[model samples]
Target: MTKFRPCIDLHAGQVKQIVGGTLDSSTDALKTNHVSLEPAGHFARLYRDHDLRAGTLSCWGPRTTRPPLRRWPPGQGACRSGAGSTTGTPGFTSYLFPEGKFSQERLDAVLHSLDGDKQKLVIDLSCRRRGEDRWFVAMNKWQTITDMEVNQETIKQLEPYCSEFLIHAADNEGLQKGIDETLVQRLAEWCSIPVTYAGGGRHLEDLDLVAKLSGGKVDLTIGSALDCFGGSGVKFDDCVAWNNKS
Candidate 1:
């Protein structure tokens, strides 16, 4: 069945649900929601309530802030030391590492914050350079790092921890111009796990294109042109129905 995978995108520690195409080049272009301060876990819990499966928690940009933690009593110093200090406030931050370091410290911190079975969850390595489309840059500044290549070795390393992969062709992301067939095909062949391709989807037909090119194995993320994302031409319900039928 085609499931509705909703997303809660976090930027600079804020929970924002935005149209993928409308993302601004500058910080001024972001729209904020006053009601979404409860962090990624809150939305994840809501998704659990709805019985929605295959959803993702995508963190963008940098992990400049400390990990969020469960609210603690004042003067108890619960978060003043140890892993408590390294961990972000629970119900607030989603424990996303923007640089994709996946270091022991980062992995430990994220694992510590998870409330459910770790094996069942799929973490999104969703990232992009601001103001660009179709290209992906590494989130970390490791000395061995080079260009924006999504090679086979990297995928192998991440496979054990993640069940699926969410990759955006940043060069074409949000442009609604067209799909990146090469990237889709490569990812589909390179990784054994299921993959969702997001970027440059301006119409319903693009979905078909993705399915065809990826041999009916790849899923897609639509934005900007979708009615839900403040676009008028494409109806979100139609896409849902299409997915249901397909």
Candidate 2:
């Protein structure tokens, strides 16, 4: 079954709804929709109403800011939801660490916001080197401070508390070019828990490719080519239909 999983990617401390392909080395080039002037949980609550479990909270680097303090001390007061309609959509939160910028304190803060519920969490092992914005380097090739490999180790440390993994072949991300078969197979063999592979999806058939390569275990995140992401080939509605049938 092809399920529709939406995302809210946070970059440079902002809640941006972006078109995947537009992201590049320069922030100025990225096309993003700013949702709030506050913390990320607000968005998470919105997804919850839609039954969107596992919405990702992605961070680009150490520059990522902490959510508002007032919202902390979870369960203290009623969770005030924003004015909107949920309409039952599925989503997930991921924290994409830029190369050499992984921080235990920052990760701890994100985990604390979840209030000890591992099932609702998904961490993105995404990283790029300094001054490089083309694509995220693979875990093995990374050598800098913000490497995804380091971030993966961090997630392993937090494994007892986390639920799923969201790893992207930054080298292939947003390209809609092709899949990195090696990475897909490796993640399926290495990770015990469920993981979503994002990057280099050019068509619907690519999903089938992933299913075969990962033994129908690993899922995928499609951007760039999706109709919503400024592309005309892939239809978001078709994905929903496929998920319904599955």
Estimate the TM-score for candidate 1: 0.60
Best by lDDT: 2
Model 1: lDDT of residue 145: 24
Question: How well does model 1 score by local distance difference test?
Answer: 0.51
lDDT (C-alpha) at residue 220 in model 1: 76
Model 2, C-alpha of 79: deviation from truth (Å): 16
Could you give candidate 2's per-residue lDDT for residues 145-246 as a string of tens digits?
243342345445756655666766655655567877767776666677777777677787777788888887777766556664455557766655555565
Backbone clashes, each candidate: 18, 18
Candidate whose TM-score is highest: 1
